[model samples]
Target chain A: MKTKLFAVPYIIWMALFVCIPIVLIVVYAFTNDAGAFTFENFKGMTSYASVFGRSFLLAAIATIICILIGYPLSIVMSKFPSNWQKIFTMLIMLPMWMNFLLRTYAWMSILEKTGLISQLLGLVGLPPLDIINTNTAVVIGMVYNFLPFMVLPIYSVVTKIDRSLIEAAQDLGATPGKVFKKVTLPLSLPGVLSGITMVFVPAVSTFVISQLLGGGKHMLLGDLIEMQFLGTAYNPHLGSAIALVMMIIVIICLRIMNRFGDGEGQAVIL
Target chain B: MKNMKKIIALLLAVCCVGAVMAGCGSGSSAGTNGEVTVCNWGEYIDEDVLDQFEEETGIKVNYTYFNSNETLYSTLNTGGASYDVIIPSDYMISRLIDEGMLEQLDFANIPNYALIDDQYKGLEYDPDELYSVPYMGGTVGIIYNTTMIEDEITGWSALFDPRYEGDILMFDNPRDALGIALLYLGYSLNTESEAELNEAYALLEQQKPLVQAYVMDQIFDKLESGEAAIGPYYAGDYLTMIENNPDLAFVVPEEGTNQFVDAMCIPKGSENKANAEAFINFMCETDVCLANMDMIGYTSANAEACEIYAQELDEEAAAIMFPSEEVINRCEVFKNLSPEALAMYDALWTKLKSGA
Candidate 1:
């Protein structure tokens, strides 16, 4: 009876949000270049492999950058005092509460020529840096926006660890670095895995930040999917095909993370 | 599990019933008599035109705005949108008509089609004048700050000049970006040859480092603030931006740019066709079109509005509303390309945008 109740909510939720859209996307993906139902849209994807390849490569680079930056920040956030941590946590989340478009717009204001940053740089006699629309700017925006999601999960697992274990390592003649390496790290592996999953997955689909801050320069997987919906792809079905592939890639990433991701340095190294 | 299964079945039944009701509501999209929802770009319309249309027709008018064409396309295409009339650019309008997304315009309702110029008629996409009515027309050009630069920045090459590295902005659009590259190569904006595309892509990659920002609406703000010295934008939008900032100046680049016309169309599935048509006819009125021109600062297609342009705006300012044939000839209107060509352009654009 409980299993049936669980199934009820799950089915309703999926029906309302996920399954319906997926069905629409699948039908559309098989549509012709003119957007009528046909098989040509799928065939179009192969002839344009570089688009998919470039999208995949950009997503991978963004994912790797997120992991590299997120891991340390999450680990540090996990070690903060409870009351202070809660305040710090909200401070981290404050930026996200602002509209995503607004945040990216804010970056443009800061990065543009004669922008506040550039003016300030000129005042100090350093030459202006044109960061807007660059891949580097896109990566910076990703790290800024997604760092909090990475921090929370690691913090959750770190808070649950028994501090006595770290003390035990210290009492047994372990250094502070050794205690973290052997004791706290192994225990916090679950949180790290969760954090990595949270950061990497969402970062792959980040379109607005890249569009706004990347100066229309970077075409990530998210932007490609958007092109289909906007009729720029010349075929709705092709857009659907691209989106379906992107979804599959995301699922694969999740599965891989579940299989081998760990916070423990030993498990991570192995 | 048996008890829960019954509850689950009941929930599914309830949801299905709700969906069926919603389906029926959507099916009655052609309105007999109800409100007509009009969605357009923010600050792009004359509010009085909307008011006068509502006043004359007695069809309740609900208006909303989008900041970009992509946003407009996505919102209208969402199908749940209640918009009876939408304004999209030439390319987007062509794309919609190609997809059978636009409703056939009944000429009996909009007899004022004669108000449209002969030159505007018989364009490639709406050749038979079946679906769309031209609203406002303009071309993309360079808007700049005269105070910032000493050189007369006459061509696309001026944009790439590194001396203005932090001062240069570009339109944050693949079409505009790609078109500029193609034009610089003395090719058509619709070129799709692999070699030409690769050449354009390479140029875009090189130019990326020089752009301070890829801006759309904010390009106006950036220009006003002196955040950027020059960027590509529609001539009508540039007119308004210059109005607000007297220091700003705009010109058609010596090489060329794309001319565009935004048109009004009714969607096939709108529930309020009567109200939609009434609103379209109302907008066609000389007074209404003039009011729309006043609010939007764009050149209205209504000949009457063009005649009244001087009365509404001083001669110097009104002159910007109309461009000479020499200026028109310097630019080309974007044509609907074949699917293969579109895909090739998209592919090159993708690599240019992503690879860098």
Candidate 2:
């Protein structure tokens, strides 16, 4: 009875904030400006199929880069004493303590044409890279911001692995490479799945990173939804419809990941 | 256990309802007879002026802020909290008047309205002169780095010129960007026609290849650092930019441009309409309006304030900031478009931004 009482506050919070807002979004998505039932909002979003595709493609690329970089760093960090690992992880997450918008703005100063990075390159007799207003900069922003999400989860899973399992594999005459391919990679699959999901979901829905770093050139699904609601267009119906579609895409992606991870990470390693 | 769960759920539901009711209650708590609620754009007025208005009137002024006119509309629509006064731009004011969301101002209370320039009055948005009082007005123009671009930038064509390729910045918003393109093509800024809007879209798409980026507030930093050579920006921003980087220069396009006016209005449900008018009258007082113009750097609608403020500026700066009547005559005020036209413009903007 006491445990049920503890859950009352959380349930109420979710019902008020999450469940009700989502219900409102669904209702808005199906209605026209006059609140009449219509498929017009969905049909309106259908025209931006390319925008959705590009958002997914960019997010997927950022997620893959995050996983590739984060997985190795996590393994190396996990080899340290557990106390040191905690300190290292804290250092990785320290940047996230600052506001995300502030960090993105910081990147703007570094990446602008006459900015610090440009000056540093000029001093080194190298050409300035004008990638601030491009998709590349957006990817850099996603990776820089979301790498901790990828690293922390995989690092936890890596550190949680029993040392005896690796020792037994080595005792069975397995090479370190073979042991890692057969054991560590498979054991870390759940974290890898969660990390990918974490990194990709926010990246796909990010309007700010693309708006600031992509220089308003790259219109992702998130920016499109934002524009519909807040931009000069001001159509909440279309924005809600786009949000519903993006939600479905993220759910599908998560489902596919869960199916692989739930099979004891076997479906992935094989 | 089940009965306990039900009781807890009921308690939570009651709490949620209480919170929502509390939120709505707080918005309307200032409904005292001697008080007035004023909502305006963020940083649109000097805080000291608000204090001054409260001090003199003894009618406690409860001031609120909104980032955009759309937000103002939605806040008023949803909250149904009676706002005594609001400051919205010309097009939004027109839309609000069409929707019967604004009150007919009792200009008799606002005798200082006569201090406004005759040129700024009787605009298309408020032709009958019944709804709004012009507060501050500005026109869109180009701000360029003189050191980077030696050529004369006489018109909007300079933005599309290939010579400034990868050096030109464009507006991140739809109406401003489309308005620039339409003016460059010698079309109306508020064209409701699909074909004319498509022509503007095509022009924007062609110019997209040359643009360094589409930016808003970031234009200040970009131009100051010479990261971008030219960008279409408001005339008021020119003074601020020149203060930072003397290399900056501004010009109203020879073709034409958007001249916008932000006006003070009383919403439909205002409780103290007379008090609201009193606030408007106070705002229009010569010294009060002059302080706003000097602080915010926008052109004051008050002719007396303009005359005084212009003298405070250098001759060239004054001319660029407050153009002659001929320039104002050439400028067009934007009108709120029908839903269909707005949707069409939005679609074209989406297509352009997506590079489709």
Candidate 3:
């Protein structure tokens, strides 16, 4: 009874911040500016199908790049001595402590025509890197900012795997590679799934990255929704509808990934 | 022991609820004469002016900022905050008036209203001269790195010139970007016609390949560092930029451009109307306006204050910063669009951005 009583504050907080906002979004999504019931918001969203496609495509590419870089780094970090692992983990998290906007702005300077990279390349008699206002810069920003989310989860899970189980596989005349693949890989599935969710969700929904690095040349789902509310468009009904659709799509994507990861990933999703 | 733990848990929950209620209570109860909330553009005013206003009036100021007029509109439309005084552009003032969101100024309280230039008063946005007191005014023009582009830039066509391909920056917002395109095509900036707007859209689409990026405040960094060759931005900001990079030059294109005026107004339901009026009156004083002009590098709307500011500039600088009557004649102010027009702009802007 006391434990249940202790949860009252948390329940109130969740109701006020989380549950209420979601209900309001759903209500606004189905209504027009005059508060009349309407499906026009959704009907008009077909025009923005290209933005939806671009956002998901870029986010998926960023997520894949993060996994490619992070999975091996996490494995290597897990193999380090315990104290060394702690230092490496700290290094991975150090960049995140700074403001996210400041880090993105730093990349803007680094990727510009006369920026640090270009100057160094010039010193070597190479052409300047001209990728500042392109889709490539946005992808680089997503990978740089969200890479730690991918690394830390996999590292923690890989570190916590039972050492005795791996030794047991080794004793059964199994080669080192086979024992590691069959034992280590299966145990880390939950971590990898969670990491993908962490990286992909924020990457798809990020407006700042696309605006600052992508040069506002392309509209992503985040930019489209922002335009309706705060940009010149000023239509909250459409903004709410777009947000609802994006949320539904993201939820569907996570559901499929969870099923593919099997029952172990269910615990992480919750 | 369990009874003691229950008592502790009950106290913790009570404290949490009590704290939230306390926070909510404090914000809405500040309707007294000692406090006035003011919302203006980010980095728009000199901080010293705010401090001086507070010192002179003995009315504590709760200052806030919004980046764009649309953000300010949404903030008020949603009742997000209760601001006593708001400074917004001319078109937005007209929209707010149409929505009955603004209060008419008591000019008797603001005696300094007489100091505003006659040209700045009774304009289209506030035809009756009842609501707003003009604060700052400027024209949109091209700023270029003279070293990078040796060709003389005399008009908006320079933005589309392939000679400066991969070196041009354009406005990020739909209104300004489309407005420039309309001006380039010899259409009125405030045209409500669909065909005219579509023509503007096509011009912008054609120019997209030449543009290095679409930017707003970032134009400062890009132009000052010589990373971009040419772009269109406010003339006042060009003045600020040329100080950083001597290679920079500004021109009010031969084809006319936007002449924007930001004014101060009190929103309806203001808690301290008299205090807000006093603050606006204080801002109109010559010394105060001159101080702000110096800090922000924008042209002052106060006639005497503008003269004093122009005296400090040399002949060429003065001519560029304060264009002669001939150039001013060609410029047009933006008017508030109807709901249909605004929606069309939003749709067209989305299409342009998505590369559709």
Candidate 4:
């Protein structure tokens, strides 16, 4: 009874902030400016199909790159001494402590034609880096910002794995590679699943990274939705409709991903 | 153990709620004369002016910022926060007045309304001179690095010149981008015709390949650092940029350009109408306007203040900051568009950005 009483505040908080906002979004999604039910908002969204496709595609690419980089790094970190592991975790988290916008803005200076990378390349007698204001820069920003999210989860899970299980596999005449592939890899699936969820969801919805790094050349779903609400378009109904659709698609994608990890990672999203 | 956990959780919950309530309580505390909230553009005014206003009139000013006119509109439209005074551009002011979102100014309270130039008053956006007081006005023009581009850029054609390909930036927003294209094609910046808009869209599509990036504030850094050669931006910002990079120059293109005016107005349902008027009146004062113009680099709307401030600048900088009457005549102000026209602009802008 006391525990249930303690949960009352959390439940109220969730209902007010989370559940109420979602309800309002749903109401806005189905209504026009007159507050009457209409499907026009969703109908008009068909024109932004490319924006939807681009957002998902860029987010997927960023997620894949994060995993490619993070998984190996996490595995390596897990094998380090405990003190080194703590230091590595601290280093991974250091960037996250700074403002996200400031970090992305810093990348804008580092990637520009006359920026640090170009100056360094000039020193080496190489052609200047010309990737700023491109899709490549957007991907790099996402990976740099979200790499820790991917690494920390996998690192934590990999470190918590039973060492005896791997030893037992090796003692059964399984090669080190076979032990890693069969035992260690299977156990770390939950962390990898959660890590993908963490990176992909934010990457798909990010507007600032694309605006600052992608140079506002291409409209992502986030930018499109932002334009409808806060930009010149000024259509909250359309913004809510786009947001609802994006949420549904993200849920479906996460569901498919979670299926591979058999449901253990479901709690991570909540 | 379970009871101990519950006790701690209950304590934490109480603390959080108490903290949130305390925050809410503090934000509502106002001065003796009461507080007046003013929402203007970011870095639009000098901080000293705000302090002076507060000092002179014991009305504490709760200042906020919006980056664009559209953002200001949405904030007001959503009824998110009640603002006593708002600074929005000409077209946005028309839209707000049309929607009955603005309160008609009581000119008796704002005696300094006489200080605004006659030309700025009775404009198309506020023809009746009822709702808004012109704060600052500027014309859209090209800013270029002289060292990067060899040819003398006389007009909008330079924005599309293939010679400067991969070294140019363009406006990121739909209205400015399309308006520039319309001016280049000799059409009204506020044209409602679909054909003209489509033509402008085609021009922008053609120029997209040459544009290094579609930008707003980033134009400053890019232009200052010579990462970009030339781009269309406001003349006011050009003054600020030239201070940093002397190689940068600004020109009001021969093909004409969009002139914009940001004005001060009270939103409907303001609690402190008198205090808001006092603030606007204070802003129009010669010394205050000069201080703002000197700091922000925007052309003052106050006639006497503009004259005094222009004398401080050199011939070239002054000309760029406050273009001559003939150049002003060549520029056009944007008016609020019909709903259908606005939708068309939004669609065309989306298509342009999506590369579809």
Candidate 5:
């Protein structure tokens, strides 16, 4: 009875913030400006499928790049003494403390045609990089901003990994590479799946990073929804409709990942 | 253990309630006997003038800001705040009037209304001069880097010229972007016809490949740093940009441009209507208006204020900021678009950004 009572506050918090807002979005999704129920909102998504496809493609690319970079980094850090590991982890996490918008703006100045990186390259007799307003810059921004999210989860799981299992594999006739692939790879599936989800979800929904870095030429799903509500478009019902589609897509992605990981992704959470 | 759980639950509930209360805390007491709340654009008014208004009038001024006119409209629509005064652009003023959301101003309380120039008065949005008091006015023009281009920039043609490809910055907002296209094609800025809008859309689509980026306030850094060579920006912003980059120049394109006026009015829900009028009256005083124009770098709507500062104002700066009467005559103000027209803009803008 006491344990059941303890869950009340959390249930209330979830209901107020998460569940209620989703309910409102769903409600607005099916209604028109005149408050009449309609299916036109859902039908309108067909015209914007290209926008959804582009955002998903860019976000997937960013997530894949983050995994490639962050997995090795966390693995190397896991080999350090636990005390030094904490210091190195803090160094990685320090940039996350600053506002993400300011960080993206800093990237803007560093990547511009005549900005710092270009000046440094010119000094080294190398060509200037002209990627500030390009899709590549946006992907770089997504990976940079969400890399820590990928690292922290995978690091926690890798550090908590049992040490005796590696010794056990070594005792057998298995070579170092075969033992590691057979043992380490299977065990870390949960962490990698969760890391992919962690990076993918926010990257797909982000508007600010793309707006500041992508130079407003690229219209992602997030920017489309924002324009409907706040920009000159001024249609909350349409905005909510787009929000519903985005939520559905994200939830579907999460479910597929969960199924593939055999529901172990949930357990990997710290 | 049960008692401990109960105590923890109580602590959590108390914390939630405290947070809710803190968020609901009022910035100032509601306008009742002697208080007045004025909501305007962020950084639109000089803070010193606000202090002087409080000194001259005994009423307490509660000032707040909104970044865009849409935000102001939504706040009022939701009844989220009861603002005694609001400063909105000309098109928004039309929307507010159409909805009967504004209070009809009593000119008796604002005798300083005589200071307004004849040109700023009786605009299409408020033809009767019964609602809005013109605060500041400006037109849209181009700001370019003098060192980058040798040829003279005559008009909107410069924005689309092939030589400046990948070196031009365009406005990100749909209204301004479409407005520029319409002006370039010699159509009314407020065109509601689908054919005309499509023409504007085609022009923008053709120019999309050449644009360095679509930007808003980012123009400041881009132009000053020479990151982009030419940009279409408000005439007033040119003054602020040139102070940092002496290589910059502003032009009021010979083809014509957009002239906009942001004005002050009281919403219908205002409680202290009289006090709001007094605040508007205070804003029109020659010294008060002059100080505001100096800080903001926009042209003054008050004739007396302009005359008083005429000697001190730089001649070249004045010409760029406020063009001659011939140029002003050629400019048109934006009107509120109907729902169908707005939807057309949204669809076209999405297609433009998607490159499909």
Candidate 6:
């Protein structure tokens, strides 16, 4: 009775969204591009391969940058008083208040040829650059928008760490740097992992940031999936197959993280 | 165990809620008695007309807007909304009629049908005027800023010219962007030949680096801000932009451009057929059309409306909106292509948009 009660809602939801959509996608992958029940759609991995490469590569880069920037900022904020911490945290998540589309259009207005920054640069002796369509612009948009995701998780964990441990490390003849390298860093790993997970998942699947801010030139996996569903691609079967594969990849990453996550279960932190 | 059960139940409930929302996404049920829905592009029509339409006819016209033609096509294609009336461009109407998705209108009820021009009747998509009624007509052309790039730019060659690098804006659509290239190559806009399409793709590839943005609907705004020097836009939109910035001028290239007519059609699934026909007749009514024409700033096909509208419009503005004999003859109407040909065009268009 207990198991049934626990399982019923999940089964219902899984049947409706996850299980059904995935079944459809898989069915489509094997079907013809014209949506006929043929094996042609799954015969080639060209679209899937290209999208997978692009999605993973872009996401990995964004995740790395988030870690590099988020880790240090979080450490700095963890030292602040409780009242100041709340204020800083609110400031971090404030960008969330603005609609994503509005924020994206704001980037377009600011990045255009006659945009605010370009005009400001004109007042100096420099010429204006078309930064809107470039890969650098894509990275800039993704990083700025997603940085808070990376910060909050790390901050929440770092703030919860007791200060006395670091004091004890210093008392035991360890340098300030050594204490951080040993204690502060290890303790914040879970938060960093969660932060990385949060940023990594959406960053990999993001289309708007790359398409709109990147001048619709970049062919990331998310955009490619969007194209299959809406744009000229129109191959939902292939899109579904590739998306299922992506979900599998995320699942595998989580499993690997779980294996190494518990420091108490291991002899070495690494 | 109870806690685990609760967690699973919660996740499942969230999923169920999400599924229901997706299922309900197409709830455009305006087909109820005495109610009709108007599906159009964002800011494409006037709202005051709806209130007046409801007041005059006692037919409630619920308005919905889409940002792109493709978005509208998806909804209509999926029967997402049981919309009574839809306004689609020439090529799409031909496809829809061919696909048996549209209802054939009974002309006897639409007495205001006489208001439409004789030339608009023989359009390639609805040659017999059996399936649809002409709403608004306009040509695609170059909208440019004289201050930004002061050159006598004519034809598609001006678009690819390296001198206008980064100052150029291109249409966000594949058909318009690729059509200009096809025209530059002296090929048909609806070219079936892959060789010709490859040439269009090659030319587009060259122009890609020079373009600042690939946009539609937003081009006029971008032009107004002096951000882009040249863009291929609807001639009517260019005129509207000119109203704000006097320096903005529009011209149809000598090689020619697309002359499009947006037409009103009632779909087969429309429940309120009677009310839908009534609304169409009301829109075609002589004085009612004039108001719609003046509000939208497009050439009204309603000849009776134009008879009153012409005296109100100055000669130059009137000529631009309501085309003369030579203008009508020069305009090229888009024809529906075969599925294979469409696939070819779509692929090339993607490469063009993808900036390859």
lDDT against the true structure, each candidate = 0.75, 0.88, 0.91, 0.92, 0.88, 0.77
Which has the greatest DockQ?
Answer: 4
Candidate 2 residue B276 C-alpha distance from true site, Å: 4.1
For model 2 the local lDDT of residue B156 reads: 96
Candidate 4 local lDDT, residue A197: 88
Q: Estimate each model's TM-score.
A: 0.81, 0.89, 0.94, 0.95, 0.91, 0.86
Q: Runs in model 4 with CA error above 4 Å?
A: A265-270, B1-28
Fnat measured on candidate 6 = 0.30
Instruction: Specify the highest-TM-score model's number.
Output: 4
Kindly indicate the candidate among 4 and 5 with the higher DockQ.
4
lDDT of 4 by residue, B17-50 (tens): 9999999888668867888899989989998988
- lDDT tens string, model 6, B4-112? 9999999999999998897766444333346887776565566777778887877778788766555666677756788888888888889888989899998888888
Candidate 4 has a TM-score of: 0.95
Local accuracy of candidate 4 as per-residue lDDT tens digits, A57-108: 9999999999999999999999999999999999999999999999999999
- lDDT, residue B321, model 2: 67
The residue-by-residue lDDT of candidate 1 on A67-162, one tens digit each, is 677667766776777788788788888888898778877887887666788899999999877676677777777777777777777777777889
- Residue lDDT tens for model 5, B1-356: 99999999999999999988877665344333488899988778899887677677767788999978887887888689999999999999998999899999999999999988898999999999999999999998989999997787879989988899999999988999998999899998999999999999999999998999999888999999999999999877888898999999988888788999999999999998999999998888888898888888888899888777666768988786667889898899989888789889899999899774
Docking category of candidate 1: acceptable
lDDT of 5 by residue, A1-270 (tens): 999999999999999998998899898899998889988888878888889998999999999999999888888999999899999899989999999989999999999998899999999999988999999999999999999989998888888879889889888877989876887766777778888888998899899887889999989988998888777658888899998888788888777667766555553331
Model 2: per-residue Cα lDDT at residue A18: 88
Q: Give the DockQ of candidate 1.
A: 0.40
Candidate 1 wrongly placed segments (more than 4 Å): A20-82, A164-175, A248-270, B1-33, B47-56, B64-82, B111-124, B155-168, B172-174, B181-215, B243-245, B312-315, B329-331
Chain A alone, TM-score per model:
0.83, 0.94, 0.96, 0.97, 0.95, 0.83
Query: In model 6, what lDDT does residue B39 have?
Result: 76
Stronger candidate by TM-score (3 vs 6): 3
- Tens-digit per-residue lDDT, A1-270, candidate 6: 999999999999979987787677677676765566765555555535655776687777888898999999999998888899889999998998998777877887788777878989989967986697777777777777889999998899899889899889989999988998899988988888888778888888888887677766656768766665665324467566667667777777666766766853221111
| Descending-DockQ candidate ranking | 4, 3, 5, 2, 1, 6
